[model samples]
Target chain A: MSSTLTVADVERIAALAQLELTAEEKQLFTKQLADILDYAEQLQAVDTSGVPATAHVLGEPVERDDAERPSLAIDEAVGNAPDPASAPGLFRVPRVIG
Target chain B: MLQSTASAIREDVASGRVSAVEVCRAFLDRTTAVNAALNAFNLVTSERALAQAAEIDRRRAAGQTLGVLAGVPVAIKDNLCVRGMTTTASSRILEHFVPPYDATVVARLAAADAVVIGKTNCDEFAMGSSNENSAFGPVRNPWAQDRTPGGSSGGSAAAVAARCAPLALGSDTGGSIRQPAGFCGVVGLKPTYGRVSRYGLLAFASSLDQIGPFTHTVRDAALALSAIAGADPSDATASREAVPDFAASLTGDIKGLRIGVPRAFVADGVDAGVRAAFDAAIGTLRGSGAQLVDIELPHARYAIPVYYLVATAEASSNLARYDGVRYGYRSARDKDQNLKQMYSRTRDEGFGAEVKRRIMLGTYVLSAGYYDAYYLKAQQVRTLVRQDYQQAFEKVDVIAMPTSPIPPFRLGERTGDPLQMYLADVFTVSANLAGLPAISVPCGFSEGHLPVGLQLTGRMFDEATLLRAADAYERETDWHAQAPAI
Candidate 1:
């Protein structure tokens, strides 16, 4: 069956998901997440021994010839950025630490 | 005019009886008056809408041939991009993000000469059952002010129910379209997965997500679907399935058709009044020359858990693109922090509780040690659920059940309990899991006057039979005719 998650588990999950939750959030998630997992425990009882996963239900991917095509302009792509006029006309972000 | 269906409006405009500009103005005025109380729309593009309407009128005046949905007013759920319009997906992160190009569906509406009035509200990233999870705010039910319009397409359903627009587009990943349509007493269609192109729709559970329409009548829903459903090169998954004349098939003839009702959906957990209405609808269908048969979808009981696992896993991967560096919300508190800190803080502040919770659950389930147990196992069960559907379909034309087990609950009733909210989707998630087309049509109302929907799940790309059955039932009853006092 499904295992109950701890507050420490929630903390680790939040970090892995790149989210910073407050203390109350951590506590709330600890309980709620465990409850959901427990509720989902019904799936554990089903025997899916020989069943294959559904990648695409009814259709197959189209084989389009990857030829040269027109694409979005550079300005239109970055027009919605928070800071569009950064040094190299690229998305500006805080520097990654070494 | 407000009571007229989109089909009726289309005919009137095409015949030059009512100008497109006049129809646009009426809808805009009605939206302005009702939107404040309903909280249905997040943006009303009045100037742009009127201008488009004027162009349609000008074209009509020039004796130009018109398309099917010539001048009907439509509302778009905020998740679908409509070039130059703010497509927020009801999340704070993309609150200011505007697309420079329109989604395939949005462009399809324009090609059909339909006027888009505004963008409707939704749950943040279309992640919740109740619209209360929206970062902007909750979209109130038009039927009952205290009740919720079932979400993430709550605003679209509300807009249609409130008569602010004759048609609106909604996306269904896990009952987002059908549940809200049931709550708001409207027709919501979740087209077969890949039947409609997902090119510019903001991704949410990509494997399960499909765009459909909400309308007052089944015919209108079919019209909207026909206008938008087709293959697109941008969406590689879009099927080259021949687009049938769905509206023509809604001839209200369901004689000798076999309708299956899963015995599992009729078990405990369904609201008493809802079950009664569902039974009554089945009886009505029986009286209309349709044979009702009991079907067994034994593994269908696991649809909810499987849907949660599959949907959350896909959502985690689909939503990972929203970092602070790009077009969406960035943390103002990121000045002195590192890049990772900025990403964390921006997402933490930008996304709502439900979104963050789903993301976390998804990440955890797909994590190394748990992937096989939760994610892969769920996929296997998903196959079983789909097999159940395939086996049942071999003996039946369409499967009928209650769209939502319960009617619209109070606004904050299940918001505090996410699992309870998840359970609300038990009856509707199987369609997404199986990649089948399903439609929720107004069947009856409960003692509390809340609308209940009878859902019909059809085989893949066989929405024709579903629409025919829904239209036949609608013709026999006045449920679709009954509107709220608001």
Candidate 2:
């Protein structure tokens, strides 16, 4: 099977990623992403019957004691915020709603 | 003084034969001298290095016992945070973002008393195979100014090769560390996944990323690994396995060690020089009393496809945190713009071409209708890749292959064709997929004099065996001793 990535699909994916691509990028990605996915279609040939998908290489879930420890201070947590000083302890962003 | 090994520097500083301050100065001077020609360092932390060095001297004067790495100078890949240092992953997004805390590995290096020389440049967000994707600029290979130092850990590898620092930290997600190390003719080790803590490493494909080191020698790689390999409460993924003294494991003996060589996998698409060097490396292993067995890793050839899918999927998710409101670059806004538009504009403006490409590819594969066809299929194939290694390890202690399919290519060589660049990692990505420890040691050079590496991959959490085999190979070859004439 070949990838048929179209401009509309590229726009949808870009929107999902919260990326504003230039018109040139959208056109370029349509062609490039298709080539990549086409190459990735090689996986379809492998009969992975009864195979389990691995999210991580390590098999077991790591568990630690439910314990309290010193965490990042409020100031340090927001230290790298784009607008750190304006809002005492919180990050300031553009208005979310009308 | 600049070419002194990490172990030698540690000993001299501890004995007061050479002050830590003096060693730091020598490396700082070397970095200043050669960095312009190589573009290896993104920022040199001179003040911090001197301060740390002086503190080491002060402690020694007071008759305090020095730490394992006492006065060794090391470079950090920009992806790993150094407290208060501008830790951009070589991307515009984080161009001015200074991390508030040091990464767990960085803190461990300090705990071992190693001096941090500076941060080195890398592929943006450690996303590309070549360092060309760095927003700052591409790092030139010391061997040939026009060729790429294999990356995304190019600067760290170049710095070690140029003798600016005895060691440098690099993270391997696909072939980041090993590929660069091979091209630079230095030793690069990627310890078992979860072997080294990744607490403050700017997340890039979390499941695959592993922190390791580039050093002038295999023993130094082993030494560096010992100082930073362990579990951390902050990183639940870090293994709880006992951190063995990796240096002690380098007995310079691989007698009767069984090495698996997948001749069929490496047969085609290999450069002639690399193939000859690999053959000689196998001969050397045999001459050293190590047993060689032919093995199969049928799924390894598919590593590039599987890696691109899984790695990009994870990258799309991890990088989603880089919205305009948080730490990092945010695009200037018009008054009426909303939050979503701000994030979009910020990422588009801040990210480089390759990073955007990966993010886009990642987002597509994980999209609703395509998830099972692409991402899930890739993961299942990933299990096949791991099982191949597991089956092979049952018969052999380690698997051997060329670190990269070909030697370092010219700058701008493969950048245009992303698929061709992905294929260069043909032999190296299996280690990451299988969570096995792997190392790249300089075996020989190409006809063009660019270096070629021989990679040895071992079972999970068995860095000792891998380090032992690499150290044993180093004992039999002088390729590691050769330095590029800058």
Candidate 3:
């Protein structure tokens, strides 16, 4: 009994994602998007009782030693940059804010 | 020679019958030939492969002891960072990004002397059941050109299926590895969460994502698992237990083993052909002296919802690093704008459509007003889903089901129906929910010549039993030997 996703929903999602979609893509994604949502919504009916909610299945937190190990050289890390200009240490991005 | 398993390759390398360079070149040549059509690889590390292969040859000449997997060629899913290699996760955002360090799995594989062939394609950020979500493009199923290779490990599965690589590494969260393996008719395993470290893997759903192996045969998959799975200082969550030699369990005997069939979960919406093949596989196991039991996992019905909510919420948080401030695509025209525009334009131009959709949906579910209604409820339901499996495990040694509801569908068949694509993961997602180890092995073929996978889900940390059952089944069946007619 799930309904299809509307074009408006797709547009809203695109806006949230900051993606600019073409008209054709929007049309195609409407049906596709609806189907995905409907399928995901199928989990709405299960009953969970007396069970502890798990955040990490392995039941352990990700931890690494705080010790500093030899790391990649800064030059080597950014050496492959497509374009390097004023920024000598990192990959440079165009200035967006005035 | 191309059809030889990783074990054989190791033996050949040790014996000097084949040098690592020869093996690497053969695989590279084959990959190059099929890659154009299959799109299985995102990057080809021919130079790297040759260099590693030569190093192995030098070690052999110097009479140095070789690692168990010496000179074996393996492909890594792009999501797992390999230092100096572009680990794009099949997203345009990181299209040119190279990792500064190798993931734990990659380092392990290299330690075993396995030559890293290249990076394979995946669904963007390991989201979506179909590889179509990859900004690079969908990987074509090697079985049928027009059909999709299941994802987000679609390329890893396809690479093995097409014989491009004998073994490949993939990450499974909500069936990414198993589902794609099912579609491509290869062997894929998702070990118990924490069995493998997640140190270098680009986080999808951290709780669910586990790096696993895809191979032509179950034992090879087991070998890869043994090599890569263990405690790591880099991943605090990694299990502290000593890594077991999974290859030692591949005796191909499951006598007196109990295998459960969840009639309630697997029977619904299963394609007739898939069901027939799965049943026949059960019959084969029964004939091999294993006991088959009917078990019910009532909470499985909620897995999809719980998985989506949790996975998306985590994805929303993990992917927030791509704000055009760090590594990833940035907007060229948005320079000198406000911080908000920088983030908005950068993400807009960087991420693929599917990724954006998930982020929005995830953010909505985790929003202040909707958290309890969506995210919190999903977590509660996840507990129920986990309990269902726990209860089922109390009654059986392992659970058996169809790896996928159906065989590979036509490439574009469900491209327009995201719901249908998501449903394709229904059979494989439960194990991820329970943090269980599971594997997909080729069982039989449909009339159309496409392969069907028989899935075996084991109890938490009971990968030995799962591999035993799968190896036993594989010994009795020829499904794993049947490759695509490429």
- All candidates: TM-score: 0.98, 0.99, 0.93
Instruction: Choose 1 or 3, whichever is better by TM-score.
Output: 1
Q: Give the RMSD in angstroms, all C-alphas superposed, for model 3.
A: 2.7
The candidate with the higher DockQ, 1 or 3, is 1
Give the range of the ten consecutive residues with the poorest summed lDDT in model 3 chain A.
Answer: A42-51
Flag regions of model 1 displaced more than 4 Å.
A1-4
Candidate 2 structure quality by residue, lDDT tens digits, B1-486: 887889999999999999999999999999999999999999999998999999999999999999999999999999999998989999999999989899999999999999999999999999888899999999999999999999999999999999999999999999899999999999999999999999999998999999999998988898999999998888989989999888899898889999999999999999999999999999999999999999999998889999999999999999999996869998886666888889999999999989999999999889898899999999999999999999999999989999998999999999988888888999888899888999999999989899999999999999999999999999999999899998
Best by DockQ: 2
Relative to the real complex, the DockQ score for model 1 comes to 0.77
Q: Output the better candidate (1/3) by lDDT.
A: 1
User: lDDT, candidate 1, residue B199?
Assistant: 89
What lDDT is reached at residue B388 by model 2?
Answer: 92
TM-score, ranked from best to worst? 2, 1, 3
Model 1 lDDT at residue B240: 91
- Computed on alpha carbons, the lDDT of every model, listed in order, comes to 0.91, 0.93, 0.85
Misplaced by over 4 Å in model 2 are none
Q: What is the CAPRI rating of model 3's predicted complex?
A: acceptable
